[model samples]
Target: MKEQKGKQEGLQHDELGIKIRSNDNPYLSADLQKKLLQPRKLSSYFIVLIESGTITYNIDLQDFTLTDGHLLFAMPNQLLTPPAKTDNLKYFKLLFDENTLALLPQQFSFLVNPLNAQTIVLDSAVKERVIKVFGILNQLFLLDKQETDTEIILAYLNTLLSELNSAYFKNREPVNLLNTNLSKFIEFKLVVETSLTEQPSINAIAEKLALSTNSLYRIVKEYSGTSPKDYFINRLMTEAQRKLRYSNTSIKDLAYELGFNDPDYFSRLFKKSTGKSASDFLPRQDLSGE
Candidate 1:
């Protein structure tokens, strides 16, 4: 939860980079809880299933309250922070690096944007199946062997993820051609992320995705409630906020680093996007005073 750089205690891993930890782990402690509640970016994909209790978390500045029979996901590099008070929390956390995900037999289209959906509500039947699968994964990671049985682990892992994918789509709208819409949206996100620094035009992105400008606008708004242009600007500003909070980069350098030709324009855009000035976005040194 504290964005573990390498291996962590009680974090069993394989050469494939799969890691798992649950509420039952002895290494889960108060400090780790504190870290979980603080804003941090992970180096791996993180998925947590809430078997019981409730907690409100912020995923990319969007608030989501997850309780029993709910699953949440945080992609690498996204900001994840929860409130500190979670005495009743009980959940299972699974972390796997990109390489591990690549080894999967299929692609999870949901991982691309996650659709601003931090949590998925599971019905009772699905919840039971989810728990059983998580149990298998937890046991696999707790083995005492020198190396994990990758084949068996991957089989179960694939089953678990496949079940999750099915469950995730189940609760969403039963629209016609969901796969097509989802694919285009995912491609749009990829283009936005990859060309974020260059401040790519919406039309260019639409062309790259083989989408008409009107179609791109409709798809983005349908999925994320924002236009393509606004979404791009927001992503850029989010990156700016991340740098301001976690790095020592100055405003001018940060602006240029984010692909802004004019530092003053970047500053103005930041202020407009965040409703706060550049200096105001910086991390505060005195927490007690705040």
Candidate 2:
């Protein structure tokens, strides 16, 4: 959907305290502005692939430039400056909340985290497939206006995300899961992506995958340098950032959605994770259009 005229991803802000904002949502009406839009941070993560023209993204005070077929991945809340206005720019920008992205397998999820600067500028064919995803989104959305059309459109969205998981992610050239047994590492991450909030503790996560907590922790620390708890929280906060910045949901409601029993506690935890109060980061806040 066209989240807002200025933002691409989804809701500018919601209760979750995450914003996956984008310069242009998938379906851009021809009537919309075509110039290089000013750079801004969204509520969710940034997955941008430039098809043509000059697109510059400043991450962590460094400007990364891209031309045709270059990919740019920005993690949550990375201070970014908009590209200098220009023309001849064709790009696909995907802004997905941490909640949605946590649904992604670990092997691929880290690709976008700012902590990892491994930007994979795929060959033309891979770039085409990535662009095709948005093509599907744009086509379904740009057709005739009807509520039923959106349901079909959402199905298309699911297809793109699923394909991304299987093609580029699961089938990639094999690599060791850091140092600890790779198979166990992949398994643990897989379960977390599938059922994030569902995992309660280290023991519970280990039990589901047929391993002892000690085994899991040893490997988790070996590869990722963090315990399972820290890993899961990272993913959870990713979602929180997307929702809080984009949607209309309130902080209390978003906390409840994320499995928090107390909205107040959720607020405190959110502050710890993002260093900003839920209300401070909310997009298009409760203010009404005049």
Candidate 3:
């Protein structure tokens, strides 16, 4: 099964898009998935190089079966799930933060695109080293909360992400040195991340990118089935749900805050998209502000 509520996949988060959950979490899932469509994936990047007994993992419309050792790299917001029994499933996943990634030199031509996946078979020696890094991370989690600089923590996290990216792309042929289209996709996502709030419309985004609306739509729709408007609205709704579930904001005020002119309209749209009323979506209405 998939985790519920909030945030885009990978490094994105908050009430706007898929949020890569904090790195401190050491998630180890043993639950079997029995759903048809996977729960929506967050906009965060997923770095998974784990071992499994016999399992199937589907990421970004690509399916890969694993026996003991295999690496998987899933890009942000590509729905993820498995269609296998979860009995005794074992795996490790590392989710990185976008802010941390920004510090990496633009010249560091590493594999950021999911289509450019590189896999490695781990012999005993290699496996031990990789496991050791995860072990250290687990140890860091147990350490008493210290007054460490946030930047220091981010530095450690970036180091971990770089190492994981390297391992996932080692000894692989460079077929797609990089696609210009893919670069556009990544750039589009960043623009959405930073500017979707000011109600940046499709026309505005297209003009900014110097792309015709039709051309932009064709590119985004080809990559992701949803249109630009739907994608942004879905992004908004993703955040709307998070705030509804996790915050103390009031419904009417929140509606205005999200750029909806009418409270009733926002509520209707929220329900239509999420299959639940804005009020109904809250984890506990009694806890929210009136």
Candidate 4:
């Protein structure tokens, strides 16, 4: 929670692009702990492993409670509102960017969050292993940057993610990395995220993915439980909500910025998607505690 001029509000790391903190960390002073109560726009992949107690976190405007043996994952660009109280909370928090993730030996499909489940309930064995890995990573991070071995850190990181990935998918339909339809679905999501402002037509996206409209619909439906068009619209509305919450841009400008030719049309679409007006969707000053 160190303050950096002109930087976004959040817990930032050193030049190594990774940070790990636990309840026992001596560096986590009282003032720093107080700062954690503020809302932050996450710039990296973040995970919180709760060892004891319970607290509710507001992520992207939704509240999720975590107690002992629970893990919460938040991806980049999401809004993270930490709990106001942590006096009894024992937790280990980890943050790493995409650059660090790319260095890993294997792809973590759960990082993409295909199941849309962010909180994973860890069993006793997995909880102990996760805590041990977190403690090792914390010790590694505490060492001087020059003395620390990046490879060792990565190896532990890989192991931690592997464990979490297994627990995240346990008792659920496992994701097949080699499944062709799933691959296409992921690619489709990437394409949508990249060209979201362009608001490309479903046919155009299907063509780009080398699939017919019907095939695209089936693929998206199979993966996301929605048609391709609805999926795109939902993504757009989500983006609109993010901007409205984080930035001071007006509705008209936001609409145009999001590729809507007419602000009124965008207004109607937002209402239909969110059941609230764009202005009403903006974060309240009192609630935000700004």
Among these predictions, the greatest lDDT belongs to: 4
Candidate with more favorable, higher lDDT: 1 or 2: 1
For model 2, residues 1-290, the per-residue Cα lDDT tens digits are 33322232342222222222223443344334222232344556666667787766665435688888777766554545455434667776666666644332343434333123435566766777767876666544344334333234445556655544344343454343353465677677667666765647778889987888888888777656788888788767766765675577888888888888898998998789778898976774321111
By TM-score, rank the candidates, best first: 4, 1, 3, 2
Residues forming the 10-long window of minimal summed lDDT in candidate 2: 12-21
lDDT of candidate 2 at residue 251, scale 0 to 100:
89
How close is each model in CA RMSD to the real structure? Answer: 6.6, 11.9, 11.6, 7.0
Top candidate when judged by TM-score against the true structure: 4
Candidate 4 per-residue lDDT, tens place, 10-49, comes to 3123455788878657335557756665567788999998
Against the hidden reference, what TM-scores do the models get? 0.77, 0.49, 0.51, 0.83
- Compare candidates 1 and 4 on TM-score and give the better one: 4
Error of 4 at 289 (Å): 8.8
The local distance difference test score of each candidate is 0.75, 0.59, 0.56, 0.81
Query: How badly does each model clash, as a count of residue pairs?
Result: 0, 28, 19, 0
TM-score of 2: 0.49
For candidate 1, write residues 108-198 as lDDT tens digits. 6556544566677889998999899998888878864446656567678778887777777775743332478777987787787678898
Tell me how candidate 2 scores on lDDT. 0.59
